[model samples]
Target chain A: DARVTQTPRHKVTEMGQEVTMRCQPILGHNTVFWYRQTMMQGLELLAYFRNRAPLDDSGMPKDRFSAEMPDATLATLKIQPSEPRDSAVYFCASDDEGTYEQYFGPGTRLTVT
Target chain B: AQSVTQPDIHITVSEGASLELRCNYSYGATPYLFWYVQSPGQGLQLLLKYFSGDTLVQGIKGFEAEFKRSQSSFNLRKPSVHWSDAAEYFCAVGEWAAGNKLTFGGGTRVLVKP
Candidate 1:
Protein backbone atom coordinates (compact mmCIF):
# COMPACT_ATOMS: atom_id res chain seq x y z
CA ASP A 1 0.00 0.00 0.00
CA ALA A 2 1.14 3.58 -0.59
CA ARG A 3 2.08 5.23 2.68
CA VAL A 4 4.40 7.90 4.06
CA THR A 5 7.36 6.54 6.03
CA GLN A 6 9.27 8.16 8.89
CA THR A 7 12.50 7.17 10.59
CA PRO A 8 13.29 6.83 14.31
CA ARG A 9 9.78 5.96 15.32
CA HIS A 10 10.84 6.67 18.92
CA LYS A 11 13.70 8.63 20.39
CA VAL A 12 15.02 9.62 23.81
CA THR A 13 17.71 12.19 24.30
CA GLU A 14 19.19 14.51 26.88
CA MET A 15 18.47 18.19 26.92
CA GLY A 16 20.67 20.32 24.67
CA GLN A 17 21.11 17.42 22.27
CA GLU A 18 20.48 17.43 18.57
CA VAL A 19 17.70 15.38 17.03
CA THR A 20 16.89 14.75 13.42
CA MET A 21 13.84 13.00 12.05
CA ARG A 22 13.50 11.86 8.46
CA CYS A 23 10.51 11.12 6.31
CA GLN A 24 9.89 9.59 2.91
CA PRO A 25 6.72 10.73 1.24
CA ILE A 26 4.81 8.56 -1.17
CA LEU A 27 6.22 8.61 -4.66
CA GLY A 28 4.85 11.34 -6.97
CA HIS A 29 3.62 13.48 -4.05
CA ASN A 30 4.99 17.00 -4.14
CA THR A 31 3.65 18.53 -0.97
CA VAL A 32 5.16 17.72 2.43
CA PHE A 33 4.14 18.97 5.85
CA TRP A 34 5.59 18.74 9.34
CA TYR A 35 3.38 18.74 12.38
CA ARG A 36 3.99 18.37 16.09
CA GLN A 37 1.62 16.68 18.54
CA THR A 38 1.65 17.11 22.30
CA MET A 39 -0.67 16.71 25.24
CA MET A 40 -1.12 20.43 25.73
CA GLN A 41 -1.24 21.20 22.03
CA GLY A 42 -3.27 18.59 20.20
CA LEU A 43 -1.71 19.15 16.82
CA GLU A 44 0.11 22.09 15.25
CA LEU A 45 1.57 22.61 11.84
CA LEU A 46 5.31 23.33 11.98
CA ALA A 47 6.18 23.68 8.32
CA TYR A 48 5.13 22.77 4.79
CA PHE A 49 6.88 22.42 1.46
CA ARG A 50 5.38 22.45 -1.99
CA ASN A 51 7.28 20.98 -4.90
CA ARG A 52 10.54 20.95 -2.92
CA ALA A 53 10.09 24.64 -2.16
CA PRO A 54 9.33 26.04 1.24
CA LEU A 55 5.91 27.61 1.21
CA ASP A 56 4.93 28.27 4.80
CA ASP A 57 6.86 27.73 8.02
CA SER A 58 5.42 30.46 10.19
CA GLY A 59 4.23 27.86 12.71
CA MET A 60 7.77 26.64 13.31
CA PRO A 61 10.41 27.92 15.69
CA LYS A 62 12.88 29.44 13.30
CA ASP A 63 15.67 29.73 15.83
CA ARG A 64 16.13 26.04 16.63
CA PHE A 65 14.02 24.04 14.21
CA SER A 66 14.65 23.59 10.51
CA ALA A 67 12.86 21.55 7.89
CA GLU A 68 14.04 20.70 4.41
CA MET A 69 13.10 18.61 1.43
CA PRO A 70 16.43 17.62 -0.05
CA ASP A 71 14.79 15.56 -2.78
CA ALA A 72 11.41 14.32 -3.87
CA THR A 73 11.52 11.28 -1.58
CA LEU A 74 13.31 12.73 1.44
CA ALA A 75 12.23 15.35 3.97
CA THR A 76 13.88 16.06 7.27
CA LEU A 77 13.20 17.96 10.48
CA LYS A 78 16.10 18.87 12.72
CA ILE A 79 16.39 20.50 16.11
CA GLN A 80 19.47 21.72 17.89
CA PRO A 81 19.76 22.05 21.65
CA SER A 82 16.42 20.44 22.07
CA GLU A 83 14.48 21.32 25.17
CA PRO A 84 12.16 19.26 27.32
CA ARG A 85 9.20 21.13 25.92
CA ASP A 86 10.16 19.86 22.50
CA SER A 87 9.35 16.31 23.49
CA ALA A 88 6.40 15.42 21.33
CA VAL A 89 5.33 13.33 18.39
CA TYR A 90 6.46 14.71 15.02
CA PHE A 91 4.46 13.70 11.98
CA CYS A 92 5.19 14.15 8.30
CA ALA A 93 2.48 14.18 5.68
CA SER A 94 2.33 14.51 1.91
CA ASP A 95 -0.19 15.02 -0.85
CA ASP A 96 -0.07 14.91 -4.60
CA GLU A 97 -0.74 17.89 -6.83
CA GLY A 98 -4.19 19.44 -6.42
CA THR A 99 -5.22 16.81 -3.85
CA TYR A 100 -6.83 18.11 -0.70
CA GLU A 101 -6.18 15.03 1.44
CA GLN A 102 -2.83 14.58 3.12
CA TYR A 103 -1.40 11.13 3.92
CA PHE A 104 0.51 11.04 7.20
CA GLY A 105 3.42 8.89 8.24
CA PRO A 106 3.47 6.73 11.35
CA GLY A 107 5.32 9.62 13.12
CA THR A 108 8.44 9.99 15.23
CA ARG A 109 7.96 10.15 18.96
CA LEU A 110 10.71 12.19 20.62
CA THR A 111 11.37 12.32 24.34
CA VAL A 112 13.79 14.87 25.68
CA THR A 113 15.04 14.40 29.21
CA ALA B 1 -9.26 31.67 8.60
CA GLN B 2 -10.53 28.13 8.99
CA SER B 3 -10.89 26.37 12.33
CA VAL B 4 -12.35 23.17 13.78
CA THR B 5 -13.78 22.26 17.15
CA GLN B 6 -14.40 18.82 18.71
CA PRO B 7 -16.15 19.53 21.98
CA ASP B 8 -16.06 16.13 23.67
CA ILE B 9 -12.70 15.30 25.14
CA HIS B 10 -13.67 11.71 25.78
CA ILE B 11 -16.63 9.43 25.26
CA THR B 12 -17.34 5.88 26.41
CA VAL B 13 -19.81 3.57 24.68
CA SER B 14 -20.51 -0.12 24.89
CA GLU B 15 -19.74 -2.31 21.94
CA GLY B 16 -22.60 -2.60 19.42
CA ALA B 17 -24.01 0.70 20.58
CA SER B 18 -24.44 3.67 18.32
CA LEU B 19 -21.80 6.39 18.41
CA GLU B 20 -21.63 10.05 17.53
CA LEU B 21 -18.75 12.53 17.71
CA ARG B 22 -19.43 16.23 17.43
CA CYS B 23 -17.40 18.61 15.26
CA ASN B 24 -17.90 22.23 14.35
CA TYR B 25 -16.06 24.63 12.08
CA SER B 26 -15.63 28.32 11.31
CA TYR B 27 -14.73 29.60 7.88
CA GLY B 28 -15.50 32.46 5.62
CA ALA B 29 -16.73 30.15 2.88
CA THR B 30 -17.58 26.51 2.39
CA PRO B 31 -14.61 24.46 3.64
CA TYR B 32 -13.26 20.98 3.11
CA LEU B 33 -14.01 18.97 6.23
CA PHE B 34 -12.19 15.81 7.28
CA TRP B 35 -12.39 13.19 10.03
CA TYR B 36 -9.33 11.27 11.10
CA VAL B 37 -8.74 8.39 13.52
CA GLN B 38 -5.53 8.02 15.44
CA SER B 39 -4.69 4.87 17.33
CA PRO B 40 -2.63 5.32 20.48
CA GLY B 41 0.66 6.96 19.51
CA GLN B 42 -0.06 6.47 15.79
CA GLY B 43 -0.53 8.79 12.87
CA LEU B 44 -3.96 10.06 11.98
CA GLN B 45 -5.93 8.07 9.37
CA LEU B 46 -8.55 9.69 7.20
CA LEU B 47 -12.03 8.44 7.98
CA LEU B 48 -14.09 10.68 5.73
CA LYS B 49 -14.21 14.08 4.10
CA TYR B 50 -16.90 16.42 2.85
CA PHE B 51 -16.24 18.92 0.09
CA SER B 52 -19.46 19.49 -1.78
CA GLY B 53 -22.50 17.90 -3.44
CA ASP B 54 -23.83 15.67 -0.61
CA THR B 55 -24.25 16.83 2.94
CA LEU B 56 -24.10 13.31 4.35
CA VAL B 57 -20.87 11.49 3.52
CA GLN B 58 -19.96 7.87 4.20
CA GLY B 59 -16.53 6.87 5.39
CA ILE B 60 -14.52 3.75 6.02
CA LYS B 61 -14.98 1.54 9.09
CA GLY B 62 -18.74 1.97 8.92
CA PHE B 63 -18.56 5.62 9.83
CA GLU B 64 -20.57 8.51 8.45
CA ALA B 65 -20.95 12.24 8.96
CA GLU B 66 -23.47 14.92 8.07
CA PHE B 67 -22.75 18.54 7.40
CA LYS B 68 -25.24 21.08 8.72
CA ARG B 69 -24.64 24.46 7.23
CA SER B 70 -27.01 26.26 9.56
CA GLN B 71 -25.14 25.01 12.62
CA SER B 72 -21.68 24.85 11.01
CA SER B 73 -21.43 21.31 12.31
CA PHE B 74 -20.10 18.11 10.77
CA ASN B 75 -20.70 15.30 13.19
CA LEU B 76 -19.35 11.77 12.83
CA ARG B 77 -21.57 8.79 13.51
CA LYS B 78 -21.28 5.04 13.60
CA PRO B 79 -24.20 2.65 13.53
CA SER B 80 -22.41 0.15 15.76
CA VAL B 81 -19.31 0.53 17.84
CA HIS B 82 -16.40 -1.91 17.81
CA TRP B 83 -13.50 -2.34 20.20
CA SER B 84 -11.12 -1.54 17.37
CA ASP B 85 -12.91 1.76 16.91
CA ALA B 86 -11.73 3.02 20.28
CA ALA B 87 -9.26 5.75 19.49
CA GLU B 88 -8.81 9.47 19.16
CA TYR B 89 -10.83 11.23 16.48
CA PHE B 90 -9.86 14.57 15.07
CA CYS B 91 -11.88 17.03 13.01
CA ALA B 92 -10.07 19.20 10.54
CA VAL B 93 -11.07 21.96 8.14
CA GLY B 94 -9.07 23.07 5.14
CA GLU B 95 -9.34 25.43 2.23
CA TRP B 96 -8.35 24.00 -1.13
CA ALA B 97 -6.34 26.96 -2.28
CA ALA B 98 -2.68 27.57 -2.88
CA GLY B 99 -2.00 26.51 0.67
CA ASN B 100 -3.89 23.44 1.87
CA LYS B 101 -2.99 23.80 5.51
CA LEU B 102 -5.64 22.14 7.67
CA THR B 103 -6.82 23.61 10.93
CA PHE B 104 -7.46 20.72 13.33
CA GLY B 105 -9.66 20.38 16.37
CA GLY B 106 -8.51 19.37 19.83
CA GLY B 107 -9.78 15.81 19.17
CA THR B 108 -12.12 13.47 21.02
CA ARG B 109 -10.98 10.21 22.55
CA VAL B 110 -13.42 7.30 22.22
CA LEU B 111 -13.47 4.27 24.48
CA VAL B 112 -15.39 1.08 23.75
CA LYS B 113 -16.53 -1.04 26.67
CA PRO B 114 -16.85 -4.69 25.96
Candidate 2:
Protein backbone atom coordinates (compact mmCIF):
# COMPACT_ATOMS: atom_id res chain seq x y z
CA ASP A 1 0.00 0.00 0.00
CA ALA A 2 1.23 3.50 -0.78
CA ARG A 3 1.95 5.59 2.33
CA VAL A 4 3.67 8.79 3.40
CA THR A 5 6.81 8.26 5.48
CA GLN A 6 8.37 10.56 8.08
CA THR A 7 11.79 10.35 9.71
CA PRO A 8 12.85 10.73 13.36
CA ARG A 9 9.52 9.50 14.75
CA HIS A 10 10.49 11.08 18.07
CA LYS A 11 12.82 13.96 18.84
CA VAL A 12 13.78 15.58 22.14
CA THR A 13 15.83 18.76 22.05
CA GLU A 14 16.83 21.55 24.39
CA MET A 15 15.73 25.13 23.97
CA GLY A 16 17.54 27.07 21.25
CA GLN A 17 18.43 23.86 19.40
CA GLU A 18 17.58 23.29 15.78
CA VAL A 19 15.32 20.44 14.75
CA THR A 20 14.64 19.07 11.30
CA MET A 21 11.91 16.65 10.22
CA ARG A 22 11.69 14.87 6.88
CA CYS A 23 8.87 13.33 4.87
CA GLN A 24 8.62 11.19 1.75
CA PRO A 25 5.29 11.36 0.01
CA ILE A 26 3.71 8.44 -1.75
CA LEU A 27 4.99 8.01 -5.28
CA GLY A 28 2.91 9.96 -7.82
CA HIS A 29 1.30 12.21 -5.22
CA ASN A 30 1.84 15.82 -6.27
CA THR A 31 0.62 17.77 -3.22
CA VAL A 32 2.30 17.71 0.18
CA PHE A 33 1.18 19.31 3.45
CA TRP A 34 2.80 19.99 6.80
CA TYR A 35 0.83 20.25 10.03
CA ARG A 36 1.56 20.60 13.74
CA GLN A 37 -0.67 19.12 16.46
CA THR A 38 -0.64 20.11 20.12
CA MET A 39 -2.94 19.84 23.11
CA MET A 40 -3.69 23.54 23.07
CA GLN A 41 -3.96 24.33 19.38
CA GLY A 42 -5.12 20.99 18.08
CA LEU A 43 -3.96 20.67 14.47
CA GLU A 44 -2.76 23.58 12.38
CA LEU A 45 -1.49 23.62 8.83
CA LEU A 46 2.06 24.91 8.67
CA ALA A 47 2.67 24.71 4.93
CA TYR A 48 1.84 22.94 1.68
CA PHE A 49 3.38 22.36 -1.71
CA ARG A 50 2.03 21.48 -5.10
CA ASN A 51 4.27 19.83 -7.68
CA ARG A 52 7.31 20.64 -5.54
CA ALA A 53 6.35 24.32 -5.56
CA PRO A 54 5.18 25.82 -2.30
CA LEU A 55 1.57 27.00 -2.47
CA ASP A 56 1.38 28.48 1.00
CA ASP A 57 3.30 28.73 4.28
CA SER A 58 1.35 31.49 5.98
CA GLY A 59 0.60 29.36 9.02
CA MET A 60 4.29 28.73 9.73
CA PRO A 61 6.45 30.93 11.92
CA LYS A 62 8.62 32.44 9.24
CA ASP A 63 11.25 33.57 11.72
CA ARG A 64 12.14 30.10 12.94
CA PHE A 65 10.22 27.57 10.89
CA SER A 66 10.82 26.59 7.28
CA ALA A 67 9.34 24.01 4.93
CA GLU A 68 10.70 22.91 1.58
CA MET A 69 10.13 20.31 -1.09
CA PRO A 70 13.58 19.65 -2.52
CA ASP A 71 12.14 17.19 -5.02
CA ALA A 72 9.02 15.20 -5.82
CA THR A 73 9.74 12.64 -3.09
CA LEU A 74 11.42 14.69 -0.41
CA ALA A 75 9.89 17.34 1.86
CA THR A 76 11.30 18.78 5.03
CA LEU A 77 10.32 21.04 7.96
CA LYS A 78 12.97 22.68 10.07
CA ILE A 79 12.77 24.68 13.30
CA GLN A 80 15.61 26.84 14.52
CA PRO A 81 16.00 27.88 18.15
CA SER A 82 13.24 25.57 19.19
CA GLU A 83 11.30 26.36 22.34
CA PRO A 84 9.26 24.35 24.82
CA ARG A 85 6.13 25.91 23.32
CA ASP A 86 7.14 24.38 19.99
CA SER A 87 6.75 20.87 21.32
CA ALA A 88 4.12 19.08 19.26
CA VAL A 89 3.57 16.23 16.80
CA TYR A 90 4.23 17.28 13.23
CA PHE A 91 2.50 15.41 10.43
CA CYS A 92 3.13 15.20 6.70
CA ALA A 93 0.36 14.45 4.23
CA SER A 94 0.04 14.22 0.45
CA ASP A 95 -2.53 13.83 -2.28
CA ASP A 96 -2.87 13.92 -6.02
CA GLU A 97 -4.16 16.90 -7.93
CA GLY A 98 -7.95 17.32 -7.76
CA THR A 99 -8.18 14.70 -5.00
CA TYR A 100 -9.55 16.36 -1.92
CA GLU A 101 -8.38 13.53 0.31
CA GLN A 102 -4.99 13.48 2.04
CA TYR A 103 -2.92 10.53 3.23
CA PHE A 104 -0.95 11.28 6.38
CA GLY A 105 2.31 9.84 7.67
CA PRO A 106 2.98 8.48 11.14
CA GLY A 107 4.26 11.96 12.18
CA THR A 108 7.27 13.21 14.11
CA ARG A 109 6.74 13.82 17.81
CA LEU A 110 9.04 16.60 19.05
CA THR A 111 9.63 17.62 22.63
CA VAL A 112 11.64 20.72 23.48
CA THR A 113 13.12 21.00 26.95
CA ALA B 1 -12.05 32.70 6.19
CA GLN B 2 -13.30 29.16 6.69
CA SER B 3 -13.38 27.36 10.04
CA VAL B 4 -14.61 24.16 11.65
CA THR B 5 -15.89 23.42 15.11
CA GLN B 6 -16.35 20.12 16.94
CA PRO B 7 -18.42 20.88 19.99
CA ASP B 8 -17.73 17.72 21.97
CA ILE B 9 -14.31 17.51 23.56
CA HIS B 10 -14.85 13.88 24.51
CA ILE B 11 -17.54 11.20 24.16
CA THR B 12 -17.69 7.90 26.01
CA VAL B 13 -19.79 5.05 24.68
CA SER B 14 -20.14 1.36 25.40
CA GLU B 15 -19.06 -1.23 22.87
CA GLY B 16 -21.82 -2.13 20.37
CA ALA B 17 -23.62 1.13 21.10
CA SER B 18 -24.33 3.69 18.45
CA LEU B 19 -22.20 6.81 18.36
CA GLU B 20 -22.34 10.25 16.84
CA LEU B 21 -19.85 13.09 16.70
CA ARG B 22 -20.95 16.66 15.96
CA CYS B 23 -19.21 19.06 13.57
CA ASN B 24 -20.07 22.57 12.46
CA TYR B 25 -18.49 24.87 9.92
CA SER B 26 -18.55 28.48 8.81
CA TYR B 27 -17.94 29.34 5.16
CA GLY B 28 -19.29 31.70 2.59
CA ALA B 29 -20.39 29.09 0.08
CA THR B 30 -20.78 25.37 -0.24
CA PRO B 31 -17.94 23.69 1.64
CA TYR B 32 -16.03 20.46 1.14
CA LEU B 33 -16.37 18.58 4.41
CA PHE B 34 -14.29 15.71 5.77
CA TRP B 35 -13.93 13.56 8.85
CA TYR B 36 -10.66 11.95 9.96
CA VAL B 37 -9.77 9.56 12.72
CA GLN B 38 -6.42 9.50 14.51
CA SER B 39 -5.38 6.57 16.61
CA PRO B 40 -2.86 7.18 19.38
CA GLY B 41 0.60 7.78 17.96
CA GLN B 42 -0.74 7.44 14.42
CA GLY B 43 -1.45 9.89 11.68
CA LEU B 44 -4.92 11.04 10.74
CA GLN B 45 -6.97 8.72 8.54
CA LEU B 46 -9.81 9.91 6.30
CA LEU B 47 -13.04 8.39 7.42
CA LEU B 48 -15.39 10.17 4.99
CA LYS B 49 -15.89 13.27 2.87
CA TYR B 50 -18.89 15.10 1.51
CA PHE B 51 -18.47 16.98 -1.71
CA SER B 52 -21.87 17.19 -3.38
CA GLY B 53 -25.06 15.39 -4.44
CA ASP B 54 -25.34 12.96 -1.55
CA THR B 55 -26.01 14.40 1.87
CA LEU B 56 -25.05 11.12 3.51
CA VAL B 57 -21.56 9.82 2.70
CA GLN B 58 -20.42 6.34 3.58
CA GLY B 59 -16.78 5.68 4.34
CA ILE B 60 -14.30 3.08 5.44
CA LYS B 61 -14.30 1.40 8.87
CA GLY B 62 -18.09 1.31 8.84
CA PHE B 63 -18.31 5.05 9.38
CA GLU B 64 -20.61 7.60 7.77
CA ALA B 65 -21.31 11.32 7.89
CA GLU B 66 -24.22 13.49 6.82
CA PHE B 67 -24.09 16.96 5.44
CA LYS B 68 -26.83 19.40 6.46
CA ARG B 69 -26.66 22.71 4.72
CA SER B 70 -29.42 24.20 6.82
CA GLN B 71 -27.51 23.52 10.02
CA SER B 72 -24.09 24.06 8.47
CA SER B 73 -23.06 20.79 10.01
CA PHE B 74 -21.36 17.57 8.93
CA ASN B 75 -21.69 15.00 11.67
CA LEU B 76 -20.06 11.57 11.75
CA ARG B 77 -21.88 8.47 12.90
CA LYS B 78 -21.40 4.75 13.35
CA PRO B 79 -24.04 2.08 13.80
CA SER B 80 -22.06 0.13 16.36
CA VAL B 81 -19.01 1.10 18.31
CA HIS B 82 -15.93 -1.08 18.71
CA TRP B 83 -13.02 -0.85 21.07
CA SER B 84 -10.86 -0.03 18.09
CA ASP B 85 -13.05 3.03 17.53
CA ALA B 86 -11.54 4.70 20.57
CA ALA B 87 -9.61 7.53 18.95
CA GLU B 88 -9.63 11.24 18.23
CA TYR B 89 -11.83 12.49 15.38
CA PHE B 90 -11.34 15.71 13.48
CA CYS B 91 -13.70 17.60 11.18
CA ALA B 92 -12.32 19.81 8.44
CA VAL B 93 -13.59 22.24 5.85
CA GLY B 94 -11.91 22.81 2.50
CA GLU B 95 -12.37 25.26 -0.30
CA TRP B 96 -11.26 24.52 -3.85
CA ALA B 97 -10.60 28.19 -4.49
CA ALA B 98 -8.26 28.16 -1.50
CA GLY B 99 -5.85 25.64 -3.05
CA ASN B 100 -7.69 22.87 -1.26
CA LYS B 101 -6.24 23.95 2.06
CA LEU B 102 -8.14 22.40 4.95
CA THR B 103 -9.24 24.08 8.17
CA PHE B 104 -9.56 21.46 10.89
CA GLY B 105 -11.55 21.51 14.11
CA GLY B 106 -10.14 21.03 17.60
CA GLY B 107 -11.22 17.38 17.46
CA THR B 108 -13.36 15.06 19.60
CA ARG B 109 -11.87 12.19 21.56
CA VAL B 110 -13.96 9.01 21.68
CA LEU B 111 -13.67 6.48 24.44
CA VAL B 112 -15.21 3.05 23.91
CA LYS B 113 -15.86 1.09 27.06
CA PRO B 114 -16.74 -2.58 27.39
Please name the candidate that would achieve the greatest DockQ relative to the true structure.
Answer: 2
lDDT score, candidate 1, position A102: 91
Q: What is the overall TM-score of model 2 with all chains considered together? A: 0.98
Candidate 1: stretches off by over 4 Å: none
Model 1, residue pairs in steric clash: none
- Stretch of 10 with least lDDT, candidate 1 chain B: B94-103
lDDT of 1 by residue, A1-113 (tens): 99999999999999999999999999999999999999999899999999999989999999999999999999999999899999999999998766678999999999999
lDDT of 2 by residue, B3-45 (tens): 9999999999999999999999999999999999999999999
C-alpha DockQ for predicted model 1 = 0.77
lDDT score for residue B58 of model 2: 98
Error of 1 at A108 (Å): 0.5
List model 2 lDDT by residue over A1-113, tens digit each.
99999999999999999999999999999999999999989999999999999999999999999999899999999999899999999999998777878999999999999
**Chain A TM-score values for every predicted structure, listed in order:** 0.98, 0.98
- Each candidate's clash count: 0, 0
* Predictions: Cα RMSD each: 0.9, 0.8
